[model samples]
Target: MSGWTAHLPVLPVVLPLIAGAAIVLIDDGKRPLRALLAVLATLAQLGVALWLAGIAGGLLHSPWGSEIGVYAAGNWAAPFGIVLVVDRLSALLLVLTAALGLMTLLYSLARWDRAGVNFLPLFQFLLMGLNGAFLTGDLFNLFVFFEVLLAASYGLLLHGSGAARVRAGLHYIAVNLVASLLFLLGAALIYGVTGTLNLADIARKLPALTGADRSLFDIGAVLLGIVFLVKAAAWPLNFWLTPAYSSAAAPVAGVFALMTKVGVYALLRMGTLFEPGGRPPLFGGDWLFYGGLATIATGAAGMLAAQQLGRLAGHAVIVSSGTLLAAIGLLGNQYTPSMLLYLCSSVLATGAFFMLIEMVERNRSYGADLLAVSFEAFGLADPDDPTGPDDVVGIAIPAAMAFLGLSFVMCALLITGLPPLSGFVAKFGLIAAALEGAAGLTPVGSWVLIAALLLSGLAGLIALTRNGIRVFWSNARSTPRLQVAEAGPVAALLLLCVALAALAGPAMDYLQGTAATLHAPERYINAVLQAEGVGR
Candidate 1:
């Protein structure tokens, strides 16, 4: 690679930042122009992401080799200057983020973009933040990117301006604000002890710390872990997730699915980077194990009890987070590849589910009235649906409802890890890996995880079945006319999941390579620290 291509590592971040700033200057009245610009920028981002992934996978190569790409800001050296590092893991996630952004942006063009000012600009900024967070090689920049995305999310959450949205947005903002404070405190403590903000430098320094310094560093690390868990929506700290996500507009909620994985990415990075090598195990292994199980239970219960499709989708996010966290706790290299595959499938399905919720709920009054009449027959009148017109016979469901129903069923299978889909492939791989002693899980722990996986899948199945019945089978007043913009994205997302299932072998190979790189952090650290004067 030569010239601009050499800077691919940073381009993912910079391109979006520049585009976002440019978009902010565009006249709000020029919606068509602004939308066009946003789509073009996101398309460019997707191209960059695919290019970087290709390089990381050795399908393409540069002077820096196939494993990693490093770009030092302003040609500065490591441990002193800002740097962006891209490896297989980061590249995969960047692609996921860009892909989702493009799809959601396209869907927003149907209507949601008009719901608020600066939607395109805010979206561009959100992408910039996500890419930066994934690529940044230091703690400080990570925090900066976190704030960037959070700020964008705040606006997106309140984009349509409803009482429920505002209430949920406030709660979301408050929780994240506290997480940000903890992030700062933890970063400061780590910097004080390690004398560097760079992730590679901190890893290099950690093995040498002694006495009270190590203890303090450990405390800081724990604080950082807590913050990440909150973002990951772990049990006891995840109450705000369902309400906030469910209240947001469809496009915004769809893209927000990636936000929780950012937390998982941080934990994976830190855990692999800072492992003590030959020392005793650190603090979070058991915490992740038990906490993940608890989260799974909570999410399962929430999904089973959820009356609204939106809330059910929110709980589905929790279930995905819990699964990944639990897998991390198992500490098996064999499981990591399968876990990565599962992560990809889950994120895709969940995002599609959120988008589908809007389409499905548009005609909910029909089923709701049916529900009300049934209750009245049982001598209990529903105040919310008081004495409406009697149900009309021969009401036909719309083609849109058929589309929504099919998509919802697919989402259900994907989320529940049922057979013949990518979800089952992922779950089976995980279970097989665990039972084979790939992660060295204790007998009890293995059984516990296996049971959790099965039970969670069962709960998801039950909840989605009920939701599908109510939404698609019950009589509705009228069928919603599906817009091409809305239906196209949802179809594309579900098709991608199908393709994932069909191409499981190659996808697993790529993910396995990513998992290997993550477990061996030296390759990453060397790639960043060795950049020196390259790409300047």
Candidate 2:
């Protein structure tokens, strides 16, 4: 933790930004150099994240005196100027973002073209925004980081600009732009109320509100929540997700796995800021459980309705998003660490599957009709020469489809809070918190969550089975050779999924510790304040 302060939180963002810009300046023909920069930038971020997490954990362990690692640019103090703060919560999220960033980069390495116009630069910029969002102590700064992410995503989403890609990317951008506008509006209103945009300051100031001002403040908070809910793809606001995500390039979709979670992080972070010290922050309880219930239902229905793998994966993402949001909304500011724990793993798993969808697509040579025909006709297209175009039907991909099917089934269970996955751990924490909140009044909300969780699991199983039976069992043939370039990165991503499943115990403990520190922002506030000469 010694040199940790010197590097400060801003270095994480800066490192990536600088790297991305440098990548853009590199000659496109130099693919190897570009890849090197991309990988190094990602690795640098990972190292920073690990170091920051360790420092944060150490600080939290010794209550006698703990440092949150606050560094003010140009020695400027908080409330009046820009500041960066790294507490246990932000530190943990930084690690998640970093790990995911690193994984996505590695996935793209063997898979994506390094010499592309926007790939490396945009990716690095997106990380810059993500790290900034996690570390910034100011509301306006958060907005800036959000835009940084949005801008980079705009390029990444439309990378190839194929008809499907362009259409999906446009929708994604339009929907999020509106959301961004609303976010700005909400921030403006909050500034009007508190006269300061620092989150900790807002927290301290919001507690003093009363009468119409309190109502106004609550309304602003709700508006801000709406923006994040949209980002997180919560029920009514999630319409944009299906098209946008379904049509994107595989790696692009994989990267977006981080975007929606940004919404979750913002919601959790801002919710904690708005909530005062004490019992679940007033209306937090209802928001968490009810929102979660609605999200679960919608996601389940979406999956059942989806037909194609891409669309199916898109819907699954929605379902996972809803699960995380509902959990956080239910747990309030206090137990969000548990929610985040599940969220991080779920994001990774969802991302890996999304990437896998592309790989599966690459291996196929026939259209849906051809695939169906293969089931009926004995002359199925040759799996080895998918390009044969023999027009034969009635072939099958029993093995390949079966593997893909299992992955889908596991993903569904993972998203639905089933055991042996990180999803279960996250849900467990939230459910326990919800029951405690209910304190036993028949706990209608808790019952609703239980039912929703069960139903989602069942729905996911049926959906996966249905898809699997069609793709792997009944027909298929006409296969293509696996592109090692693409296959390698996807395999790497899958390994992450296995690790998440296998290492749930240590991950949960880390999450619990991070959650505890988040609930008590004294360390966070103190870290920033102390950087400005306030007492330890």
Candidate 3:
């Protein structure tokens, strides 16, 4: 790596940092200037991410080892200096976080940014944290980046300063603070046992551990996984996720769809880091499969039971997490590109859905759900609802409602894993891969996971269908005023999903390559530990 390309990995972190400070320097009254600085900074970050992904994706197929760029800050070597790595997984997620960040930022400009002071600064800082989290190559920097993002999130979630936001933000903070503590404890244990913090260095050392050290290492690894699961909103540990996420400002909630993935990324990244020398994934074959199934079931049931659009989207996030975790359990080292494809598709759709939820309900009357329920229970035709919420879906929607209606339906399709979208393609791929049955996963386990997926999808369909009918068909609705900034971001996200479906073949090839690289840790360990740093 040379020229500007070698430095591409650092820009994702630096761009946001500079933009945030620049935004802070601007007067609060100069909203447009602040907005311009923020947007330009985010756009630049996105461009860098895409460039890095292109380079890393290309490197995935290279005959040589796959390290697109490994930045050794302060001209130091591994285990001593700060390192940022751009590889298949990190690059893929950098692109994801940046794209999602841009959309949510655009949506925020429509109104959410003005809700509080320093909103723009906090938002940019959040981006910096997310990018840093994805790009950092070791547990120490991972914790640092996690704190940076969590600090920013604490501010962002309370942007609107409402009662719900306040309560939810407090809960969110408490839970994450505990997770952070667990992070430290886990890292300390692992470091004590393994004698290293750099991921690559740790991987090289793991195979050398013996007896009680190995046992302690396993315990530390499990603790670390628990922290990730809590962040990923895996059931039992995920109680704080829904209320906090749903109560946030719409744009905050939209961008937050990436937060859960941060957890999944850590799990996926470190799970194999401990399984040195082609041993089956240390954590993948363990409790992750059953835990994932439970999470999916819980999230699906929550979605069915939710009346609020925001909470439904939150639960849908959980369902997506469950699906991915289950796959990680069953497909570790087997390398299913389909799983990666599903991940990208689901995150895009979920972000779009969260953003759209606020828009759909922007003009909704309070107590609408209760009133509809009342009418349905008594079989009375309420004047407010020409077609009651429970009425069969056969209403002719006015032209004014077309965009919202169509977008809502698209969201429904994406969430429900229905036909003619990336959701169906991704989910179908997952089902097919499961049926094939891999090394550690039994045929019965594969079939059980398949059933869970199908059942979750069915639950989502019923819930989202009921939601759509309630929002568009049953209640009389007038179009809410929408800005180009607001609609464009949501449209772009959904369009990306459509593009994924349209270009499934090539996308799967790239993702499969990613999965294959992930299973092979030798390449990662060598690239990181043997990199030629500055002044070499």
Strongest candidate by lDDT: 1
lDDT of 3 at 525: 79
In angstroms, give how far residue 125 of model 2 lies from its true place. 0.7
Over 317-369, each residue of candidate 2 has an lDDT whose tens digit, in order, gives: 88777777666656454356566776776777778778777656655543331
- Per-residue error for 331 in candidate 2, Å, reads 3.5
- How does model 2 score by TM-score? 0.86
Candidate 3 similarity to native, TM-score: 0.91
How well is each residue in 88-166 modelled by candidate 1, as lDDT tens digits? 8999999999988999999888767766678888999999999999999999999999999999999998876767888
In candidate 1, stretches whose alpha carbon ends up further than 4 angstroms from where it belongs are 277-284, 365-398
Ranking by lDDT: 1, 3, 2
Clashing pairs in 1: 332-439, 366-476
- The best candidate by TM-score is 1
- 2 or 3, which is superior by TM-score? 3
Tell me the RMSD of model 3 versus the true structure: 7.1
Compute the lDDT of residue 316 as modeled in candidate 2: 77
**Local error of candidate 1 at residue 247 (angstroms):** 0.3
